[model samples]
Target: MQRLTQLITCLLGTLLFGAAAAADAILPKPFTATYEVTYRGMRAGQITFKLTRDDATGRYTYETTADPSFLARIVISNAAVERSVMEIGPNGVRPLEWSLDDGKPGTARDGQLQFDWNKKLVTGVIEGEKIELPLEPGLQDRLSIQIDVVTSLLRGEEPGLIPLIDDNRVKRYSYVKKETTSIDTKLGKLDAIVYESTRQGSSRQSRFWLVPDREYLAARAEQIRKGKVETVMVLQSVQ
Candidate 1:
């Protein structure tokens, strides 16, 4: 049960967002989306994602909530929440803060991080331990990384290797374009561009099916481990 809960939480962490448009390209948009989550071919739960913007400050708050289903509730009792606060600029999305609450308060899985771009550092607490790391160019948090990738795609640019702060360490993920395909969703059948992302030195890979006509929204996503699909999230609705 503990292992299953952990896998579900990991799937929730990988879910992406549907973004808005900027002056010349699509940027992060304030919207709400829902996805039906499945784990190991079984219905697991649902994930709700929201992105809100402070128009005056131009800062965006992206959040996601994972609610386990009735069957899954036996093992996963609480909903996990992840949030990232960031801004979009000429370069790309810059994450200012990131946090995760695994639904259990006071547990080691809960953490918060603050990014100080001026100081060129990221300071935070994870697993009840303090951490500080030097910032790198184009650094992003877990949630913001997807937005950055989508932004690059919207601009007709390839999102090669992206460096993001994951938990206590900075990890790099390589994004590669895959063949274009069509998928059936609640909204109807739509064409999508597939992109695969793999973390360095890991066998786990995630694939995203994004619909370009709909502002590059992710229509479906799957997390694969050892070449076998472990979790899947399909778009239910978007607004």
Candidate 2:
């Protein structure tokens, strides 16, 4: 009788776990956060990130705009807009579309990727070049990946290997938790968890600090390439 009781208990536990996972897959509340961008420790630009959800369709849209500061504009002279549309299911994020607009002051280069989950195909173009790749589960775009990382962390799950779509290519990146410490931001000093990105065979490295109380939002990010700091983004405001 004891063995039978143990078996029933295990089955109940599994069912409950599955239910909880499905409920939390909807994602956090809608929010907007602005970050001050810096390059080599100087003011450069600003990036505003926004996330919205559709209750009826259970879809999400994530958008970010990076604009160079007036002074910095003279040096860089370009801005970027990135966006991603996806849905979070019982498994993870299922990206539907990803796009970016990057170019000079007036002329812009447009790149977009469309995911057809039903057909299991990914089609897109990057810099006017045709692209086609296999569609895989758990795939995320550059922008959506950041959201998934924070969501997984808040759920007490390890942010392990992540499949991300970038430049019309699919790449799996591994993230390592560095440490949990306090960092000063425009808002104030706050405790944060830091994570470092490992991109195989790439010289560029990136890091992010996530604030727990704020739904595990990314408070700051730094990108370095070839031992030189390329850009930095720090939390400015949240709404």
Candidate 3:
């Protein structure tokens, strides 16, 4: 009778755990977060980023505005990359091709994504590259980069990064876990799952935070590579 009871209890516990996981699978995520980025310089960049769910197509759009002239608006879907480039010194902005691949020239439109063993959807190609954020000494310039990606998995969303490798570029992302993190914004804190990427041999961390209740990354933070906290590279706006 004792052994039978123990087995029954274990089975019940397993069932409960499965139920909880399923419930977490369908939670809505963040739609958008307008933030600012700053580095060593006091320069500022205005950013409006969003993660919108097509609902009909089940695809998500990860988009942001960092450069005002060159790379103004970038929209990335599961396998599509769309960029709007501004023609300088003249008329207006024109659309350009955007690629999010690692080895290939990437596409002018869309990036490739895949699912891990945890069933969380994430970026598939691992491109060894890094894009440096403009900074100044003694002062952190505020800048923001919008992120838009699709899928039921929103794990690569957070601020700060732990780069794994870097020959040309450092690589870093989030570890799948059950911790509750809040996406820090100038407005307030919103709960999210943050991922990060970094170039090798650097002491900085930029993170992507996905608010499960929403559909996209609500915020991101880049810390300079200083002592203890290291020097941080988090600008609220992109100039």
Candidate 4:
């Protein structure tokens, strides 16, 4: 009977460890990253993105702000802010709410989104119209997609087809893994896995280089629109 008791205890221990490990896979390591944004090889602005998590409650908030630089700052009013608050769980990251401000006055482009998990629905205001749509399981928003991608890469898993809710439309995005490479940044040389995604029905493409050592944070990103580089951001610092 003692031997049987010992065997049961061992099995329980193993099961508990497995559960904890799985949960850790999705729990984000809180960090803030600032990237230098450039447009068509000319300095346009800077983007600062931050992530924070509460381990006890499994809640997280991700926010990003874009600020113009130099001449662009004087000529353009293109500042913007985006944020998402969600819950991280064993199943995946569930977006509780999201908001966007385009910095345009007297325009209806600013809106908010709310996710109803129990009803499997999303309600948001878009262009001054309130709409409701069915939400899919494992659905992610534009801001949350970054977290989803990083988490999947950290776990050595494919991001698959991510369903994104943005601009009053539900669009599906596909991520293709390219080759692993190293990126030279202000911080230093770092190894990363590259991923590319093309905009559906457009010539725009975006590439992300995520460094594994830094918890799969994107070290650099490039956005090309219509055969011209629209923006490029290299990791400037992290905290």
| Best candidate, TM-score | 1
Clashes of 1: 1
| Backbone clash count for every predicted candidate, in the order shown | 1, 0, 76, 0
Q: Would you list the C-alpha lDDT of every candidate in the order shown? A: 0.78, 0.66, 0.29, 0.66
lDDT of 4 by residue, 67-111 (tens): 667765553345656678998665667899988666667546667
Deviation from native of the Cα of residue 184 in model 4, angstroms: 1.0
Query: For model 4, what is the alpha-carbon lDDT of residue 239?
Result: 74
lDDT by residue (tens digit), candidate 2, 11-123: 11000011124466436667777777766677777666777889999898887665667876553434556678988765766889987665354333567889999998889
Best-fitting candidate, scored by lDDT? 1
- What does candidate 3's lDDT look like per residue over 13-47, in tens digits? 00000002444333223343344433343323343
Q: List the residue pairs that clash in candidate 4.
A: none
Instruction: Tell me the lDDT of candidate 1.
Output: 0.78
Q: Each model's TM-score, in the order given?
A: 0.90, 0.81, 0.36, 0.83
- In model 1, the runs with Cα more than 4 Å from the true position are 1-24, 74-79
Candidate 4's TM-score reads 0.83
* Selected candidate, larger TM-score, 1 vs 4: 1
Ranking of candidates on lDDT, top first: 1, 4, 2, 3
RMSD of each: 2.5, 12.8, 18.7, 13.5
Give lDDT: candidate 4, residue 219. 74
The parts of candidate 3 lying over 4 Å away from their true place are: 1-30, 67-201, 207-220, 226-239
